[model samples]
Target: MAVAATKEPNRLILFTDAVVAIAVTLLVLPLVDVVPEVAREHRPATEVITGHQPEIWTFLLSFAVIIRLWLSHHKAFQHVRAYSTPLVLCNSAWLLAIVVLPFPTEMVGVFDNSRFTTGLYIGTVFVATGLQAAMYLIIRIDPEVASEDTPLPGEFVLGAVTAAVLLLLALVVALTVPGVGYWALLLLLLSGPVEWAWRRRHAVAAA
Candidate 1:
């Protein structure tokens, strides 16, 4: 029986970075459009920024979110030296979610906070985080994908899963609770402590 060939991951990593750059760039386009609308309305020049506070805020928020996600993706692939079909598919799906995020981000800025908008925005984030978690898990288990000299850390694998779970929890809070809205995303901060505890527990076990 013939074995499937593995390919170097450099091109895949470069492609992922390019897609992430485009997605991050797309997040700011709506804010740029606001400038023309303000001019047409004959409002004070400052209103271009001051009047569109919601849009500005959401753009900043999404920018931070996309950057953070990209950082996580970079971390996940840092130790990878090879790739397979499943890894490619997983990464593509993650990129698709990243591309879709700007739509919900715009919706959040334009529409009043509602279950639908909040759910949609948080849900897109959740999907992206979940896909990243899957990538970490795949890399951890697949000997063909990661480098033998520098193994992927167990904390990274658990941290990705922990972050995804927090995002899911945040999505649930945003959907079910009125007035909570995007504040629900604060749940994601728990990931650091959770991952720390996991590391401590494992260190004790190893000791």
Candidate 2:
């Protein structure tokens, strides 16, 4: 790797962090800033928030999803340690997906019961996770963009792939199941155990 390629790309990471932070912050505006006068006058703000329980749930779920994505990005970039045209392009694609999340998130809040919104939300997840997975592969292929002798941690790549699979499975269940629909997205909580088992097995193997 050239000396330039080995240098840390702090600006890239900083810019990406800002973008992700802004995207996550935008999630709250639809719930609070856009309250109608009717909602404002008839009830205490607390009560109004309570009444919008489903929206709160959607907000939290979307929030968690974005945070998961950030962590995956963080993991991959630790190995990245540099930059390239393909690497920058991959990062841009991933960030594009991140920024788009808030719209579908609002749609989830507005159309909690509608299959279209739910499917759209899941579709967003599919695209985002797919982009993230591509990022991992791109970094691996372009060693000049990575730390010397470094490969992405297996657990990290597995986690990203698991997320992609989980999203695809959620979409399938949402479409096929009679009543459960997008509630299948709650299945993402299962990634906790999956990651735990992945780490446990890798730890034992390393030992």
Candidate 3:
């Protein structure tokens, strides 16, 4: 049996990290500066924020979704010790999705409950999650690119499955109840606790 050769591409991971960082940074762009007269003339601070509920939702949802993707990206790349051209290209597509996120956030800020806005937001998340899944497959396919400390096969599968489930849940909520789809953002925010508890139980059982 012949072992697959590993070729280290130095810039791919660094480029990927930079793109992810920028994506996360842009998530907060929906926050706008409040004019002094607007605050003093219209209503109190709480009411002013309430007037900007859509923008607030946009910021919160985009922030949560970006963070979720970034964490998964961090996890995936942490195990990967090297990269190939195709993997780099796929990752670029993934980052392209990241770049797109703010547009949907803008849509949400303007037309939060509109079907079009909800659909666009859900679609972006679905595509991003799918891309992340593809990255997982690329790493799994070329074992030589990953380090010995890479996540085990079962753990990898579990992480991928969880991401898919989260994406699907977001989509379902958008389709069935667009009004509640924004709350699905909260679902992703709460996922860390749920996964942690599940892992703790499994660890105890294994022990």
The best candidate in terms of TM-score? 1
Q: Say which candidate scores most in lDDT.
A: 1
**Candidate 2 lDDT by residue in tens digits, 114-206:** 778778889888889988887787677667876776777666667777788888999988877878867787778887798898789879999
Give a tens-digit lDDT track for model 1, residues 3-79. Answer: 32267888998999999999999999998898889889889999987888898888899899889989878887888
- The C-alpha lDDT values of all candidates are 0.88, 0.80, 0.72
TM-score of each: 0.94, 0.83, 0.74
CA deviation > 4 Å runs, candidate 1: 1-5, 205-207
Ranking by TM-score: 1, 2, 3
Higher-scoring candidate on TM-score, 2 or 3? 2
Worst 10 residues of 2 by lDDT: 1-10
Between 1 and 3, whose lDDT is larger? Answer: 1
User: What is the number of residue pairs that collide in model 3?
Assistant: 0
Query: What lDDT does candidate 2 reach at residue 142?
Result: 67
